[model samples]
Target: MKILLATDAYSVIVNGVITSIKNLRRELISMGHDVKILTLSSNRHSYIDYDSNVVYLGSYDISKIYPDARFSLSYTNPLIDSILTWKPDIIHTQSEFTTFSIARKIANKLDIPIIHTYHTLYEEYTHYFSPSERIGKYLAKKFTKRIYHKSTCMVVPTLKTYKVLKKYGIDENIYIVPTGLSMDKFSIKYPKEELELLKEELNLPLKSKILISVGRIGKEKNIEELINYLTKMKFKNIHLLIVGDGPYKNTLANLIKDYNLNNKITFTGLIPNDELNIYYQMADLFVSASTSETQGLTYIESLANGTPILCRDDECLEQTVINNYNGFRYNSFDEFSEKLKLILNNNGLYKNFVENAVISVNENFSSTTFANKILEIYEKYIK
Candidate 1:
């Protein structure tokens, strides 16, 4: 199966969707299936290589770090031409962005099958725009219906998203293909000495409880609320490690200053993939308040690294981090904070969560299984 994967957001910046695509492409290639990625170009196109087969559609004067505006609005001819020339067996488009429209155009032109994956649940994004929530939801449903309805099949990360699509009258073939980090990539057999060396190198205290949150540091993530809640807490030996860089970094920094939480939190902006597991291993607990995550990969990744996760009440999250069994979940900030304190105080109970979280990831969310499921879906549609 020769697959051409298209995405709007492709950069060195840490993104779950891009990461998952790369993993899937890697696995597919490993399985002896040809796969190519088509994406809009960032500056320094020479810095990265997608082999000869991977196509760069158009080189916009876009920076690696995109601003708040939607500048990459129009699809260029080069992209259209690339799709025509390659003539893939199937086109798998990600995100409900401008690029999916291009995929739709190519599919319509070539009369080939297009598999669209609904990565981000748009209704969550609507809250950031304004106070009036109804309009945002209206636009989200309208746009979701328009884009997803055209595809031969729509792939979503969770059953929650599948249900949402059903409500929008998108009765098209919807497959649940949850994305996962390659366990082999993080499957380093660190000797006890090496593990100790890593702990020393990161300056992680042996007894200090480390909490990690990795994802886009944006308003939609509700990171500010997490920071505020942490400030109010009275944990004696706790360190908060905030990973990834985004537009809201400075805003979060200011809030940290205002709340005088500078000492408690460490902003390690965009740690490389190689060192990510070190931080994950160091963390006793992982927490994210983001209601926007379709499937929180970091939560699973942390759990896979033997760390429990705490997240807000969402269907996808609930499935991953089973409350009181694996990790914890709460309805509101107050509720979340209460649970956080309990997890922090009860040292004996922490081991159960850590063990269960790893069990959950290994049993249900392995990348190998995810890749096979995706390939099965692709084969079904393409054949």
Candidate 2:
């Protein structure tokens, strides 16, 4: 089957939606299916990354509203002509923005079914464009209803997001498909020497208990809460390693300074996707305070690497992070600190969490399983 994935975020912009698309594409191809991505190009001119099976449309930087993202221009004649010629069997959209509009156009013209995945909770992202929360939520609900109702089927990564769509009055057929990870990518054996060298280069202490969080350092991530919690605890041998970069880096850095946590926290900025597993392997635990994730991919990635997760409680994590099973979840900073201390101090209990982490991901979040589920949906819609 020739499947086309349309998304506003891709390539240079690394996020969960892009990661899900990439993993699904990879798995589909490996299973003898053809997959192509239609996304915004970082360059002023659009082009194709044939090797990666991507069709990039021309776009202008809109980082002021969303960091490292671009707003695609009107589709050019050549680009549209090229897509029409490719003759995709179905259109699966990962966003509700510019590229999604193009997906609807192409699907309509080609007489193909359109499927969409609701990835982010737009209501939580109003801070980027609107100053008023009431106005932002109203706009977000309207936008969601408008775009989602056009889809033949909607894919949501969690039941939480599915409920949100239903509440917005979108009567489309919604399927709950948890995002899958290529577990091997995190499970692959790395060169011990290289891993040690990276740790040394990053100035990570050889003896400290490392708690790492991997994602964009954005306001939505609630990274400040983690930093503040760390400062209050003031553990001498514990360090927090923040991976990934975003618009909020400067603000987070200043917050760290104000709390006098310069030595307790370290930021590695953006690391290449292929090399990200090394950092996960080096951590004793994976931690997050962000409530904005629709499906937290980092949580799965960490578990895949045998690293236990310590995250704030949220609806999206209910299926993945079980309290006192694979990992612990907290509702407040005090609870988070208490849980962290318990896990860090109790070696036997921590070992159980680490063991369960691997089992949980293996049984539930395999990339092959994810692709198969999505393929089933695609076949159902294909005539």
- Tell me, by TM-score, which candidate is best: 2
Q: Global CA lDDT of candidate 2, please? A: 0.87
RMSD of 2: 1.5
> How much does each candidate deviate from the true structure in C-alpha RMSD?
3.1, 1.5
Model 2 alpha-carbon miss at residue 180, Å: 0.9
- lDDT tens digits, residue span 172-252, model 1: 688888886677766664555766675566565656778888877877888887787776776668878888887789999
Please write out the lDDT profile of model 2 over residues 173-244, one tens digit for every residue.
889999899877775856768767877898988789999999887899999888888888878999899999
Error of 2 at 1 (Å): 1.3
The global Cα lDDT (0 to 1) of model 1 is: 0.76
**Deviating ranges (above 4 Å) for candidate 2:** 190-194
lDDT of each: 0.76, 0.87
- lDDT (C-alpha) at residue 94 in model 1: 83
Q: How do the predictions measure up, each by TM-score?
A: 0.88, 0.96
